[model samples]
Target chain A: MRVSLRQAFAYKLDFIFTLILGLLVSLVMIFVWYAVYANSGVSSIGGLSLNAMYVYFFMVNALSFITYNAAVAQTMQEDVQTGAVSTAMARPIGYNTNLFLNSLSVAIVGGLTVTLPMLLIAIVLSHTAVSPAALGLLLIEVLLSFAITTCIGYVIGTLSIYFVNIWGIINLTGFVYYFLGGSLAPLSLFPKWLANILMLLPSQLMMYTPAATLLGIIPMDEIIREIAVGAVWLAALVLFTLLWLRRISRRVVAVGG
Target chain B: MGLKREIKFFITCQRYNWLSFLAYRMQAFVWLSLNALFILYGILTVTIIYGVSSGISGWSYYQMLFLIGTTGITVNAVWYLCNPNGLVRQLRSGKLDSTFLRPYSRLNIMLSASGNVDNSTTAISSLIMMAYAASKIGVDAAGMLLYAALMAAGISAFVLFVMALSVLAYLLIRGANFVNGVLNFMSSSSKYPLSIFGFAGQLIFTLLLPIGIASYYPAEFVLGRLSLSSAALVFVLALLVGAASYVLFHKFMKGYVGGGG
Candidate 1:
């Protein structure tokens, strides 16, 4: 955490540019959706008012791109490529623990600079009152989403060690999030068959369900159900990562020995 | 005579670029899949938008697909040529100096000699897609001819536009990584009507970015919704942007004091 924060702050200009760009992209989405509303001549499409749509896009960008630690996969790929995984695994703190923490650290730092401001702007623009209880639930979901995504990242990263290259896979995952995850448009607006399949998958957890839950697009009962499902995903992913890591590390050791 | 030689040299080296793709057929598949997905993703976004509503003003679903298919050709070609990602790697590794050592003029080397041919697959696929969209709309021969002309014009302008931005990105190292991210956004946004952005937004995209010329203006003109005033202005601005980017790209080359290797 300390190292990541230090590295981020060391590139002060890069850090600032990233914040500005994040805000700019979110602002552009706001403009684009507002145009959709005006030109479509609909007060609401997908049952989201213009303001609610604004909040949705804003929250989706914040959660899916910024708060999401994509670099975990990149860093893991690097560690494997550079043979740093050997050194990383030797640490007493352990590799999986270290990877998970670094992922959270990157997210927390980004959440501080980009997500917080975008959340405030969305709240102000949408005028949706944020109750403390809802805020707490949102926090839990965000943490859970981070874990599942980080596991997904590690899985891809681990796969990189196997495939020797997975830029295509990484980008394919990003595309899934961009489309099925609701970064481009709300899953609600998608064709019923598509949206239903997406809901059955974990893609909705990527952006739609959490943001929709807080914004009241999903009902209270559904929100609770989504949270429970998210927890299951995290547990399953964690177990998979552990078993996968143990298997890979043994092979790595065998190869080296 | 000198310019003719450089052009000839560029086309020759460009053959080598394509040969290199054939050399590594697997890498080509990766890029082919990525670009194909990219084009389809743009088409899907339009479908989703229209599914929800009539979609962007004065543009039907097929018409939007036509614009998007054109962008698959234009934007992906720009990426193929001065790919923001490859440019970053070239600049970072100081491999740009390799271009300097070559016989051809620096401009030709930078634009033609350096690009990957992976997007050629995209060009072929997008042409088929564009034809499908055109058949849906019954775009006439004249409209197709004019659209081709507009695409040629837009491609030239956007090529320079991206080359200039890539240099600017190198100047801003922290922000440099996102040159392509911004380019991707520009690519994706071009699929919809530019008029949706309003007059001011239209001006920004046309004069400053020139992406409107890329796919939007051609699509709009064929659909008979293009504003002559804006379109005329954009054509003029695109020429100026193309000229300025030529100078700026060369100017910014001085910033490379190699050791990024």
Candidate 2:
């Protein structure tokens, strides 16, 4: 936590810049939906009211800020490439644990410093009224979502130990995660059949499910099902990531001096 | 004679760049996939949104496709022609000192050095996509010609925007990182219709930053929604911005203290 806080402070400029960019993107999305709603002359589309749509995009933007941690991927790749992983392995704490903690710290700091402020503004400007219960549920789901995404990051970082130039892989992973993870547009906006399948993936927990819950668009039964599925996905990713890290750490040969 | 020599120099650089890229076929393939997947993602995002609603702002589905295609083409053209990656590297490694000693203008050397083919895949794919969208919208020959001309202007603006970012890199220690974040925002948000962004957003994008002029306005011109006089004004805006960026870059270069001690 201390290290993460230090790191956050260290890159405070980046955090602010990124926060501004995220807000701009959310603003753009809000205007797009507003224009669409006006043109369509409809109260709502895809079960999202105008306010709900604004709130959903806002939550997704905030959720994205917390979950998408590039530090873990870049640091892991660099450590492996420069053989710093070997030295770090000699320490008592495990490599994955270190990375997970660093990632979690960044999420908490970024979420608090950036997303929280943006979320408040979004809620205020959009006039979104969220019940305590829904807010609590959204918070819990965000935690789970954070864990799942961090696990994926760790997995990608571990892959770098094998492919020295995993830049392409990282870009591919990001594109897929953002596209399929409901950051680009809500999964609800996708074709029904496609959304159904994508809903089963880990990404559902990352942005869609939480954003939906926050907007109060999700039903009680569906929320329960999503939680169950998310828990299962989280467990699987955790196990797979741990095993992968253990196996790779045993075989890692640092290249750079 | 000098212009001919400059063209030859750029051609030689591209020849070597492609050769070296082909030597690592796997790497090239990876880059191609990355670009291709991004384009696919853009197309799909627009499709999904249009599938949900009528169209973004006042633009139709095919028109939205054209907008994204224009953005993709302009961005890739800038990436291929004036990639700042080499400049960032040169600045970081203090190699700009040696790079500046060459007979050619530093700007020319920087632009031509380490030519990028990574975005070529994107350029080609987006052109095909744009053509298909134009055909769907029944764009005429004159419309197509105007689109092409406007696109050239857009690319000029896009390159200037990147050059502005590059010049910023020479001014600050972490300017590259800052520029990257801003560029990501510019590229991503500009993929949508400019109407989606309100007055302030439009002003920033169209004038201060000028990405909208580079992509959205050109698209609007192609669609016949924007007048020729307005399009000409936009081209003039591009030229003015490009000239300003050139001056700023040269001014910053004068003060550049290399990263090395």
Candidate 3:
């Protein structure tokens, strides 16, 4: 883990460029939503205030920095497809353990890369207040969300063994999560039934819960409920990953080395 | 004879894709349904906004839908037909070397590299919505024709610009997947009217990204916001941008070192 962390920091240029790209996109989206709020001139959309909306979007952008695990999934998929998985399988450590440690290291680096710069920018440009209590809660929510998202990445990577073309699936899932998870717009903006249905999906745990917590839109009790829900989902996802890996490994017929 | 040969080649490519898609017809149907669902989401968002405000930037709900539908169609058309074949992969894999050796023009080979019969669904749906919106907005045939031409030019310019950017990526990174993702996100914003954004945002889309011409300017022309002269100027600008990018790409190709052995 320490070695991998050091390696992740060694790739500083990729991290910096990716951080800059994330910041630029987040700023652009904020400005877009700001325009909408300015035009509407109201604090509430289906009962969300302007400040609430801004806070929600800010948290969305911030959490987006830490929650990406697609890189790990893609790396694992490449290894599996190119027969590098067998090389790792021959190593002393289990392949899954190695991947988890590597993913954790990279995720830590990515989280800091995004969160640190965003913290500076948010302090300078944003007007919303974050109380110490709220900040602490926000941090907890973000960590849980990060864990859940990483588990999702593992499941996705494992499934890539069966479906060689994971690119389209990743993209499609990402799009659905972005929209239906209420990252782009508030859940209240969606139809009530559709919003309820989306809340049942794991995607809402990624962006919506964190954003809601940060914005103080969710009550403390509700935050506890969401965290519980996220933990349950994570547990299920891990189980699913184990089962999938076992099934696929048994069915795996080596094609070309 | 040349036309016949081209037609035969196109038909052969079409048949190949058709057979492959037919093998997984359910998957294709599901994918098409998802695409439609996304469009419906866009329309629904616009409807909700219009419910509060009479229109966005003086355009009605149906007109906004038309703008979005057309933009979706144009973008998917490029991605489906041109991008899969024209991107850095062929160059990296040395497949482009064979094209260079061929008697046919490089441009022709590149353009025809991928066929997107599936994307016709988007185009067909867009046309239906566009027709409905145009009739409601009292758009004449000439206006529609001008809009169509602008859309074509915009799509061409965008594809060329992106291809040029991909070549630039060769000097830096082997794969331009990140660039492609960024472009896809930026283009997604084109579904809305550009005027909704601030002046700086508008300028970024117009000059930096060129997405304004893709949907906004043409929609503006249809709505009579842009004068004929302005539309003509935009058309000319699109051609210039496209030609310049094509030239840049050819120059870049001269120096491209093929990836891998």
Candidate 4:
């Protein structure tokens, strides 16, 4: 964990670039959504006033930044390509454990340096009524969101063992998460039928749930449901990851032997 | 004769790019799938935005599609042929020196070597969307020709601008990247009617970014919302941007000293 933290801290330029990208996305949404409100002459669209919509995008950007750790999958792809996974497996320390720590460190550093400040500025800029309780729950949800996304990273990373190149799949997975997870738009903007279906998907828990909760657009009951659903999703992902890892470990062993 | 040789070289480079992509069938298939999904999702985002509200004032649904399509094609086409990523790599690898050894001009060599085939499919999809939008909006024959001409100018300017950016990136990392960020911001702004961003946004995009000439002005002209004089000015503006970027790129290249590989 310490080593991973140091590694992340050393990447100052990357952090700045990532921060700029995140801010630009939020600013673009600000213009687009603000324009929509001005053009429509509506006090609120999708139950969000202009300020609330701004906060929603800000929170969405922060949450997406904190939770995104596709490096695990990408790193695994490189390792498998270079035949370094077998060497790691021979070490006394476990391979997945190290990767998990690295992922955790990355999430922690990003959240601290970039996401948290943006979240604070967003909250200060907006007049939304964010209660302490809702804010607390939102924090927990963000952590859970990070865990579930990391699980996805591991699953996709394992596919590198079977395929020669998984960068395309990795890129596709990112776009899917961004679109489906409410990073692009709030669930309220979706069609009624489409919103209902999206609500049932795990992707909603990643970005929409916490962002909506803090903005006070969603109810207390829904926040509680989000927590429960997120818990179940994390457990399922972990179990699936373990079983899949067990299956693939033997394939590596056979090839190496 | 030189122009003909450059065209032949460009086509050959494109062919090699296609061959390389076909070699990785799985990668090619997945990338194509990604482009298809981007089109689907891009259309969905526009549709949902309008479904909720009247959308940006004075613009109909098809106009936004046309604008989006034009912007997508300009950016994708420029990026496909002359990518900043490729330039960054070349600079880092000291590969610029090797390109200088080739008989072709520096710009031609750099562009041909860096050309991307994947974005060709993306540009094609945008063309389809633009055609559909034009059919819906009933743009006249003259309007269609003007749109095509402006798009050519826009693509040329954007490609040259990206070349300048790569050089700027090589010289100063964050400063150039800051401009690139602004470019991204402006490009997203271009997807909508620039009027909505007010006079300030319009000036910024037109003068600093050169984005509006590529997509917004052309789309507006086709829709009859913009005058022909305005469209002509935008076409001229696009050309000026291309020339300026070409000068800027060459100016920086003069200072670049690459040891032969």
Candidate 5:
């Protein structure tokens, strides 16, 4: 698995391009919000200072690189649609395990190559405060968030057995995450009722919680609780995915023989 | 005869899409609902921002909503109607060879070749939203008509610009998804007022990417910040850029040694 991951990273150009893209977008977001802050003149929307908002968005940008799993979902959907999953079923490994590992590998490598550098750059350039305790909490939250997000993606991908085109679903998921996850603006900007509702959705865990943790808006205990919620979501999604695969596997009549 | 044939081809494409969608109409509904959610998010974000402030750059919340709605309709229409057929796959398989061999002009064939009828729902929904927003803005009939004309021109300009860029991508890298990524980025960012990013960002959108025309410029005109002459100038610029891209793309295609099937 590691070898395959290394091979994936062997494409230096892809890694570089992805990194450059991430950085460019992060810079764009930073400049954008800078203007917003300038216009507003008062920092601390929902307990976030100007610097803190920058850090939050910067982290959102970096964490975005970490949680990138759409390609895996896409490949899985294609496999199911094209009967390529049958080939995987024929292999000795459990199909789900194979997928989980492949996704993890890609996520890890892509995260490190693109996201880690951006995070480091952001830390250096910005006036982001990162206490030792907060850093530890943020790291744990990010890991849990990634797991939950990947599982959600897996379920979405598995739904391809029934739906011919999941691209719209994927795009919709991405759009929601971008908005509701505090990517576009802080969750504090949302109406109180909307914010409360969004908290229950797993999309919030994807980018918001980690950003909040890093910004020190979320307390340590609350961060732990959020992680627990993320875990529950992940476990539920995994179980659901397994049941779905079992049902779909039985219905799979190998086509295009 | 040519126009009739083109219309028939377009209708046939739409019919095929309809039949395919019928097989999984439930899925289509689900996808459309998801798309609605996205649009709703855009509406909510703009509403919230506008609720806080008067306007981003002399345009009110309702006017910006109309801008977003129109941009969404036109961009989705272009993607569904043109992209899949013309740039992505044709470049990959060098099936553009057949396009060149066809009796029609290459530009016409390329622009009208493929359609994504599934996305028509999205386009229509966006137009409906645009109409709703326009109603809220309460423009005079003349202003509304002018807005409509500029929006039509804007959509054409955007489509032409995207097609041109896609053509450039074909020449540069046969099957690169880079242009699609950039387009996605543009669509995502354009949901907000261009003024959000400051003068530099606005200029980049206006000059380099032409995203302002997709939504911002027309909205500016509608808000009475931009004079009719400026709006006309923007429309003319869009046309000029589109023409240049078509010419440049054809010139590049001239050097093509067709690929194997």
Candidate 6:
């Protein structure tokens, strides 16, 4: 964790830049959604009060800034492509563990320093409440979201071992995750049939569940169901990651050292 | 004679790019599939928004689709026409110095090198979608021609803007990060209806950023809400911006000290 903090500080510019990107997106969403509600002359739609909708996107923005794991996939892909993986593989610490640790540090440091501040500003600007109980649950969900996303990123990065360029697949999967996961818009706004299907998917637990919980949108009974489902998703990802690492180890070769 | 020679050179480079892309068929397929998937996802978002409300700010559901399609066309057209990614990579690697040494203009070399058949495919896909949307709205042939011309101008402006942004590579080695970040913001925000952003947002997008000219104004022109003169004014504005940015990029190139030659 300490080493990860140091690394994060070393790449402070990237952290700041990413934070700015998230801020811009959040601001744009605020303007767009506010107009949608105001122009349509509706006080509420799809169970989201105008105020609640603003809060939802604000929370979504902050959560997304932290939970996004494309950096993990990119880093691992580069390591393998550039043959830097061999150096890390030969070290006392396992490569997956190192990748996991580094990613965790990035998330923690970025979430704390950049995203959290944005979240605060968003909460203040949007005039949203922060429920103590929901905040507690959101914390756990964030950890699980990070783990699941990182695992998926690891799998995407592992593809670089076989293909010279896996950016296509990486980007494709990232888009699917974001669009289906409610990062683009609230899953609740989706058609009922589509929303029902999306709810069953684990992607919702990553972004929607956390934001919805934080906003007090989900009921207590459903919140427990979400956490249980997230647990199962995390466990499955962990098991897949372990098997993936073993396969990578067997086929790994040093390329351009 | 020089123009003919440049055309020949550009075609040769494009051919090589296409061949190289074909060499990695699987990767190319994945990229194309993903690009199409993203387009579909964008359509889904618009559909969901309209489903919840009657329409955004009096624009119909189909109009929004046309707007999205217009954005896709402009974004993908500029992307395929001149990727700018190649220039960024070359500039970083100092291979840009090689292009500079050639008799051809740097812009020509940069554009020639960045041609991608894959992005062209996506651009064509956007065009087909836009045509479908336009047809649903009962656009005439003349209107279609006008939209095409406006789109061409919009794409030119967008490419120039991207080039101007990349000029920072000459000053800061890691400048592409900032450029990419801003571009991502513009591209993401522009995919939705412009009116949904209110006055301040609309003003910034219309005047300062001018991303709306590429997609929004063109949609408005097709929908008959925007006058022909107004639409032409957008095209003229885009031309002016493109010209100014070209001059700025040339000035910035003078400050570039090669990374490696």
Provide the lowest-lDDT 10-residue window in model 1 chain A: A248-257
Candidate 2, residues B92-155: lDDT per residue as tens digits?
A: 6776667667666767777776346888888788888888999899899997788788778767
Which 10-residue window of candidate 5 chain B scores lowest in summed lDDT?
A: B50-59
lDDT for each candidate structure: 0.74, 0.77, 0.68, 0.79, 0.70, 0.76
**Ten contiguous residues with the weakest lDDT in model 6 chain A:** A7-16
Q: Of the true contacts between chains A and B, what fraction does model 3 have?
A: 0.01
| TM-scores, each model vs. reference | 0.89, 0.90, 0.81, 0.93, 0.88, 0.92
**Which scores higher on DockQ, 2 or 4?**
4
What ranking emerges by DockQ with the best candidate at the front?
Answer: 6, 4, 2, 5, 1, 3
Q: Tens digits of per-residue lDDT for model 5 on A58-125? A: 77888876664665677677787777888987899977778778877777776776667767776777
**What does candidate 4's lDDT look like per residue over B43-80, in tens digits?**
77678889999987777899889888887787678758
Model 1 is docked with a DockQ of 0.35
CAPRI quality level assigned to candidate 2 from its DockQ score: acceptable
Q: Write the per-residue lDDT of candidate 1 for residues A1-257, one digit (tens) a residue.
A: 77778977864765566566565666666676677677789899889888888888778877774435577787777677677788888899978788878877888777876777888888887789888878887888777777777878887777756654566667777776667777777888888888778776666777888788779887878778777887887898889987887787665531221
Which DockQ value does candidate 6 get?
A: 0.50
Interface RMSD, in order shown: 2.8, 2.3, 4.1, 3.0, 3.7, 2.3
**How close to the true structure is residue A58 of candidate 3, measured as C-alpha lDDT?**
61
> Which residue pairs in candidate 3 have backbone atoms (N, alpha carbon, C) closer than 3 angstroms, thus clashing?
A43-A49, A43-A50
TM-score of 6: 0.92
Worst 10 residues of 2 chain B by lDDT: B170-179
Off by over 4 Å in 3: A1-21, A43-55, A71-76, A150-163, A239-249, B1-41, B44-57, B81-86, B89-95, B109-142, B172-178, B257-261
Off by over 4 Å in 2: A1-15, B8-28, B82-93, B112-117, B169-174, B198-200
- After superposition, which runs of candidate 5 have C-alpha atoms over 4 Å from their true positions? A1-32, A71-73, A170-179, A239-248, B1-4, B17-23, B51-57, B84-86, B113-115, B196-198
Q: Residue B150 lDDT in model 4?
A: 86
Residue A241 of model 6: what lDDT? 86
For residues A1-257, what per-residue lDDT tens digits would candidate 2 score against the true structure? 77777865654565466567767777667877788888888998888888888887888888787766666887788787787888887789987678778777878877887778877887788777778988888777888878777778888888777676566666777677787888777788889999899988877877888888877777978887888888999899989988887777677776578
By the lDDT metric, which is better: model 4 or model 6? 4
